[model samples]
Target: MTLDTKKNVFVKLGKFLGQFKEENCIKNEAVFGNDLFFEKFIDLIQLSQSHNGWYTPEQVYFSIQSWADALTEENLSQWLSHYDFSKVKPKKVALILAGNIPLVGFHDFLSVLITGHDVLVKTSSNDQHLLPFLANYLIALESGFENKITFVEGKLEGFDAVIATGSNNTARYFEYYFKDKPSIIRKNRNSIAVLNGNESKEELAVLGEDIFRYFGLGCRNVSKLFVPKGYSFDSFFEAIFEYQDVIHYEKYANNYDYNKAVFLMSNFKLLDNGFLTIKEDSSYGSPITSVFYEYYENLDDLQKRLEDENDQIQCIVSNNLVKNSIKFGTTQKPNLWDYADNIDTISFLSII
Candidate 1:
């Protein structure tokens, strides 16, 4: 099969994805009502809800849309900084898909696709559906992309370079197994927010979107916050309160009861929200049913602390005009430009 230059790959891939999102691509005459073909994400959102997390229907729609858009060659081209792919040679690649959030496999999939390499995906059972669906759609529009990617449900085997995303515990296992291979074995990362006094309530509400979207399960989700000591909790709550309707009271109430009991048994205290529980911890990300936040007395001290822990943070959200920064409203939706690890993926592509 001839490799289409990145230019052609981008355009065709975009067209294919655009076509895929439209309602007509699906054909299930047996069931005429709202279909999971597009709405399959409701299952994901529901699974998340069981753990007391939040996911609006719109958020799920957009999340799937995000996956579709990012997997395309057009998005991949932009991610590679519009580099000409005709210049690179195909590289061998193995990608261990992460099930932590929706479509987390996309980055690795896009990287391999744009680099003109074969991708072998070891899918997580919790999150196996999307990537295979995507490959089939790509096959429909661009057989080359279809043929270039492969999906497997088991452990990954041989490859020149492997990229694995898993919990911090699994990183050591990945390292031990793939030591002979050039690999990017990523450990768990949590995104954080460093709030100053200037951010308005509306912005904070948008920030809530990030925390609630995907139920704070994604690596890009901002879990910890650094609000000014005197910052109004009311302002922060007001902004985030718009999402209150999504509080899945039953699930959250249960978790609240369970965790509260555990805390009581262990002699712990948590500020309550009728459903969600908030506690203080140095760790950024928490389980869907929990949120741990620390109140800092000084900006300089907070900055020093964040700098020390920067390696564990995938993105930093703030409303302040900090370039390359993940601001409040923007955390849930990352553009084509925000590369994981801020690595110049195109530069890597240019090399091979």
Candidate 2:
């Protein structure tokens, strides 16, 4: 019923999740209620791929590890320290989750509940299993959560506010339909990186993680690159060569073959390294197997251009080259305070 109570439940949940691994899963008896839920959670993480091919054990484990790190008492306290939640009045907040990657909609779900609001979640069909499993875990940890969470199977109704994530098209529909309600409606956005050609091989290799993690399915994954003119692709290619194993995944391999064929048929010049393709283009949204690139003439001009088009961008990954840019390999491991779309969900929930 209180914030500390909620935080304790998640901390215990985090401890439970920390036991699952791809190579060896170790059960921690100190974790409460593990007898009933621990093995089942491990089974769900292992079988996630059967529900959606994209949810492979490696990918699902990465997501679980990220959450395990985030739900610590120290991190949760620091994240919540910035906000004043004493004035929050309980309201039902409707959430429409996006399932492009594992746990994509979890931050919103966590924000709504941690701020003392009742959450009405409409889970994406692709991600129906994981969150509900966590919700049940939370309830088992503390029965109070049972009244604070609800999953909708049909039309959503009787909510004071809404937060929805989807494509630009679906966002338009949400904007029109929820015009009368207070809301945060998110649309498609992509991340990019700027390269001055001085990056070390290690830095560039870590950048490959930003590109290839989650099979490049997440909004935080770097989908585009900005390089100075005359930049060579040789070093960049070499740095990411280790991730060539990604091409062995059947789904990613199929996409690689299909998108590469289409590019070749269209006479588009490409820089290929077997597993990933880099194409010079002005667009931010790239296909799953490829990343778009553009050559910038001046850093200042490019900065202004990115500022002008800020709404279309989710994050920028660079070594202090762009304003508010994230460090290499750190985009996917966002802190609790790293609000999506630069919008403060906690502040939004507190006021509503």
- Please name the candidate that would achieve the greatest lDDT relative to the true structure: 2
- Best-performing candidate as measured by TM-score: 2
Q: Per-residue lDDT tens digits of candidate 1, residues 210-250? A: 77776667878777776666665666766677777555655
TM-score of each: 0.81, 0.99
**Shift in Å, residue 37, candidate 2:** 0.9
Query: In model 1, where do residues sit more than 4 Å from their true spots?
Result: 1-59, 67-77, 82-87, 249-256, 321-324, 349-352
lDDT agreement with native, every candidate = 0.65, 0.94
Candidate 2 residue-wise lDDT, 1-352, digit = tens: 8899888888888888888777788888888888999889888987899999999999999998999989899999999999999999999999999998998888999999999999999999999999999999899888998999999999999999999999999999999999999999999999999999999999999999999999999999999999999999899999999999999999999999999999999999999999999999999999999999999999999999999999989999998998989899998999999989999999999998
Residue 62 C-alpha lDDT in model 2: 92
Instruction: Report, for all candidates in order, the number of backbone clashes.
Output: 1, 0
